[model samples]
Target: MLEHELVFALREIALLGGILGDVELSSSELGGILGISQQTASRRILELEEAGYIQRKPGVKKQLIHVTESGSERIKAEKEKYERIFEMGSRMRFSGTVISGMGEGRYYISQPGYTLHFRSALGFEPYPGTFNMQLNGAELNKLNILRNREGYTIPEFSTGDRTFGSVRFFRAEISGEPCGVVLPLRGHHKGVLEVIAGENMRQKLNLRDGDEARLTVFLDR
Candidate 1:
């Protein structure tokens, strides 16, 4: 049979953690079934395992393989991830961080009137001050941006209201980096939630919404 490369590759790497007994698949065995070389199959297994989509366990005779909760997450996330890449391919819009000569590493994000600045980097550090630095792309590529797979859902303290499908990032104006993303409330909410980041962010990184803070979201299930 023609292999279902993507799905099979995913499953081959991570076994379905069944409700009953433990079952594990070795790369050599799965490789033969999928018509891929053992090394290729083994690499794939490692990749999936590293990505947190699957896990391996030891049994008396064989290793146990199973899909983790994160596996479902990857299945859902791949769609959004591909969509973002496709959008970038179609129209080259990107989000980059800008830096100012300030001693501290601060970035800004904003909506129409308000802005906010929180010192962070999901990890990477920003220069003292710069404008719109590109994300992890080639030097020739002017746009720097990162796409996160999972979005957050946070409930408001005052009301039972929840903000669904969230993404966070910083933007700077010193080098023309656009500010963070803007998205509306999803599903249960009657109307869209308009987020206004505070003004302190505006002064630090230099941000404006329509000009830089453009983003989209998928409603919560």
Candidate 2:
């Protein structure tokens, strides 16, 4: 495996470029971000472009750089490895404030395909509704950590009207109650986490909107 710092440098450059994936970076500026000399930064950029991790385009002013799909995959793989190492040594904790969802969870969780998978993988039938929570503070970072873990996959299946995308479930303990955290691979929610249990978690835990909840996720090695 390549060094993590190099992967991090690539990921940071991607983030700097935003959604358009076009970023203007000079050797000096890149050097400042990476804490290296301008010459070193220039060489690193050339090396990455040659390695097909990024593409560089000469511009009138600063050069335009875009991270390629290969670069994104490399960073993602490194993140997964990092999370595995983290989970091995520490108990992952997630903290968020209760929030409302778009009422889609009930419909989705109630689907026969999803229900069947939930029962089989999680060892319990999930409640129809999901307890949604908006991540706070560093919880968003922790959510990214959860994203890296390999979870039980609920495969996509077609219904009479439409098809539902696959969802991943990870084992978690919500306020000491065993539960499962669900993450849709393709969904609208970004910083929000949806949790499910055998019963309505709100009623079982006596939770309401604005209440803060913490979950200790047990990730498999």
Best by TM-score: 2
Per-prediction TM-score to the true structure, in the order listed: 0.35, 0.58
Which parts of model 2 have CA positions greater than 4 angstroms off? 1-91
Q: What is candidate 2's lDDT per residue for 1-221, written digit by digit as tens?
A: 24565676787798797225779889899999989889988888887887788888987899999888888788778777678665653457777899888898899899998888878767888889999989977668877777767778778999999998888788778877878888888756579988888888888989899999888777762
Write model 1 residue lDDT over 1-221, tens digit each, in one string: 22235556665444443322345777787678679888987877677678776677876666676766776566556556668766643333334333222332222121211121222321222222222232333522422222322233222222144322333333322234322322223333211112222233445545643234332323111
Over 4 Å off in model 1, which ranges?
1-8, 11-24, 33-35, 43-51, 58-63, 85-93, 101-221
Candidate with top lDDT is: 2
lDDT of 2: 0.81
Candidate 1 local distance difference test against the native: 0.41
RMSD values, in order shown: 15.0, 15.7
